[model samples]
Target: MGLTELLFVKMTGGNPILQGLLGGIVITLMNTFGALVVLVWHKPSERFLDASLGFAAGVMLTASFTSLILPGIERGGFIPTFIGIILGALALDLADHLIPHSHAVLGYEGLAQTRLRAVWLFIIAITIHNMPEGLAVGVGFGSGDLPNALKLMLAIGIQNIPEGLAVSVSALSAGLGAHFYACFVGVRAGLVEIPLALLGAWAVHIAQPILPYAMGFAAGAMLYVISDEIVPETHRKGHERWATFGTILGVMVMLYLDVALG
Candidate 1:
């Protein structure tokens, strides 16, 4: 069988589209697991949160390079991937410049600075960070390579656990009231992926040629988040060592999974 067909056999037993949507939903829901931590235990320490964010940054940075950009280079060549990366970075730069959002500890970013409540600001910050992950998942499936897409889904889902915890912590710090509500808010923040995944798959169907560019773009977008948002947020506090270890661990785990699953 061909590669896509073989990948299909390995994922969901046959249907790439169905598998794609299901994978997207499953990965996004992983966010709830982190949020659930708040219900079972006390809020995590700032050091723990910083490490988690750093871990997430590591995972995404690896995914961008190993999973997305390289595949784009293989499929569409160097020039396309290069341009896509630049465009992706530029797109994120524009969003960062135009939107107003607050980081976990870094205060407010984006051009449209505002006096918005901390909870809302936290939501905006995470939303911007996560939406691209959903897109990456979608693009993976859109590439018609079920195994690669599944790998991306697994990687992103695993990393999202820490992200969910970070979001819950941010909400609580913002005085978002009862632990249950904050956890709920954190889990719900990931729900945007449900639709975006489907849309990305559909876009792929409509324009198959764009797959390589899309992959590169997704990589660039994710890289932007890692460098501009997650890394800085992780290091803004005093847990630089823990965060560094977390980042190393995260990268190793993702690499292992990629090899094991591939």
Candidate 2:
């Protein structure tokens, strides 16, 4: 099958597991689409990247509460949800120390001068950052909440566009390859989400007890990424105004989606 066909095949929202897989594929495709934009722009403006990343940050920030934490508290109660949030944040914090994390602007953090090429390291770091997002989408589906899952998927997929473009531009800037191949790697980086999403759905399906915790955990992880990675990177550039504006716009869009869809 062609690349597009391969990725787009057999998406259904019937089974929660399948639905989770569908969510992963959808986000991946969105990222791919964004990366493809590099074909047109050749070199995306840093100001625009900062703004778009800011928008992504906003989406994840609001989504953490609107789609995850709030519903978690409603279903699982405050104590469990609160504890789950803390655990989630702690887990990501621990991961942050070992491997590097990446942003479009700031590049990799905590990366040592290892044998691994910076390009590979950058891809690995971005994949790590994306894991929680995949898990969040999966948990949303696993909760057996159709509307919530779909909304979560839509939000993530929408945000993935800019994220994907960022990866593509970064890869090209790193001289990873020609534009097509750079975007190819961008698609490859996002492929990590597929398996993680599946794992999330399976875990939630088998245990079911972890749904509330999963929700809280996913939300917490996303919030951590926002505070730790996205915000810092976006603000570091001289484009803080654009970043802030984009963030506010993203928040508004997500809130509207949550209200309109939920």
Question: Can you give the lDDT of residue 58 in candidate 1?
Answer: 81
Return the TM-score for each candidate structure. Answer: 0.91, 0.91
State each model's CA lDDT, in order.
0.82, 0.84
Residue 70, candidate 1: how far off, in angstroms? 0.8
Clashes per candidate (backbone, < 3 Å): 0, 0
Candidate 1 runs further than 4 Å off? 1-15, 113-116
Error in Å for residue 230 of model 2 = 0.7
Model 1 misses residue 190 by how many Å?
1.0
Per-residue alpha-carbon lDDT of model 2 for 37-59, expressed as tens digits? Answer: 88888987989998999999999
Worst 10 residues of 1 by lDDT: 1-10
> For model 1, how does the per-residue alpha-carbon lDDT over 154-211 read when each residue is reduced to its tens digit?
8999999989988887888888878999998898888877677777776775687887
> Model 1 TM-score?
0.91
